[model samples]
Target: MHTSTEFLLALWTLAVVEGLRVTEVVVPPFLVIGQRARLRCHFALEGEVLYSLKWWKDGSQFYQFIPRNDPKMVVFSVAGVTVNVENSNLHEVELVDVQTSSSGQYRCEVVAEAPTFNTHVLSANMTIIGKGRGALSTSAQFYLLETVNFGTQHHPYRAPWHALP
Candidate 1:
């Protein structure tokens, strides 16, 4: 008895009212080798209860948080991802002594509990740069350029050759 438009509108209303959304994903675009990095995932759960929060690096899951679990937190090992589990939780994760190999796409996935089990995901890229040995490596220079183009407000990317030493 309902028109197509009415049905579509009702679906939209339901989703908007009961949806879990990832509002922001904060991953530093660049970092110096051996420096620590903090990644944050912010979400809007609307009226849904949180089921789990997960962090993935280059398609490999490295961290998870489940509110109903015994410990509520779990960690997995992935190449180049050294999670500082002691400082990690639902809202943020910290990585200690990041290395050049840590550069990769990072994703945050959030799921809602119970019958619906709605899920949402968001991702960002990060790059790690080593100090100049003698001259900058080709990949390092490339990363510097890329960071200049797409840099975060908190850590504005800059290349100061003189400051290297």
Candidate 2:
């Protein structure tokens, strides 16, 4: 019951309705342990109040940042996942101290109270590598260099526990 013209019109309508594309967030591919990494959110729409921001995964809410409710920033984790909220910028959030538990597809929800704009959902892909290693043991040779004035230093003193004999 549809003509060629109708089909063309329908296609254009579909494109316009879904045209407001979501923003893309870029983050580092890898982060060192105890170092901080930030995921930046940018949207086509600007000047939004950004009333509240939330991060979620697997249909479960992880963390939230709201200016009115929270006095200081908060980072919370449950079920082996973590979330961090930073509202330093205008309409973006920053997560610091990237950990292995922070690797996943995190969905960011931003809301604007006035003007009633569409809710924006941005996803960030996070990955963590190079962690969980024991500290290196102290070497006797390293200590010998520092104690050059001790007992002529002709022969280095080796700890009995670490000596071959």
Candidate 3:
């Protein structure tokens, strides 16, 4: 009977080990390829110091911001991925020059300093909407610019032009 009570107590203790509460997660569903993007993760800790905050894209580590790191490590970023952390205020980050490859599920993982040593993770998805597809479609529209000083007159609006496949 006493052993059963001890087991239950241990289980409860382990459940409370995760001391961080993620309040909100913000991500845009559609973004232009050339425009900038922003991702925010809001969290509240239970009397614990922040150890590290990291961002992952499609299960791969992309960006990391460590607060309590000694020597104050610079912003961690992956190759080919441009994450602007200069304007980041502890819980948010901006992405510049977004690309079609930037479309993916992004996860924010926050870790608390020792004693509790808790960790929490939240994720959201984003999509990049480009002007055109990888391959041009037969029905795609093509705009013709006005002819300067041409003998014939030009239409003010562009007409729908389809190319042969």
Candidate 2 structure quality by residue, lDDT tens digits, 45-74: 454555666666545676666666645344
Question: Could you tell me how far off, in angstroms, the CA of residue 154 lies in candidate 3 after the best superposition?
Answer: 46
Sum up the clashes in candidate 2.
0
Candidate 3: C-alpha RMSD after superposition: 13.9
Query: Which tens-of-lDDT digit does each residue in 104-152 have in candidate 1?
Result: 9999999999888899999999998766555554543222533433455
Q: How much lDDT does each candidate structure score?
A: 0.86, 0.54, 0.72
What's the lDDT for candidate 2?
A: 0.54
For each candidate, what TM-score against the reference?
A: 0.77, 0.51, 0.66
Q: Model 1 misses residue 27 by how many Å?
A: 0.7
Compose the digit string of candidate 3's lDDT tens values, residues 32-121. Answer: 567787889988886778887887888878767777655433455664357775766567778888887888888888888887668888
What's model 1's lDDT at 76? 94
Top candidate by TM-score: 1
RMSD of each: 6.5, 15.6, 13.9
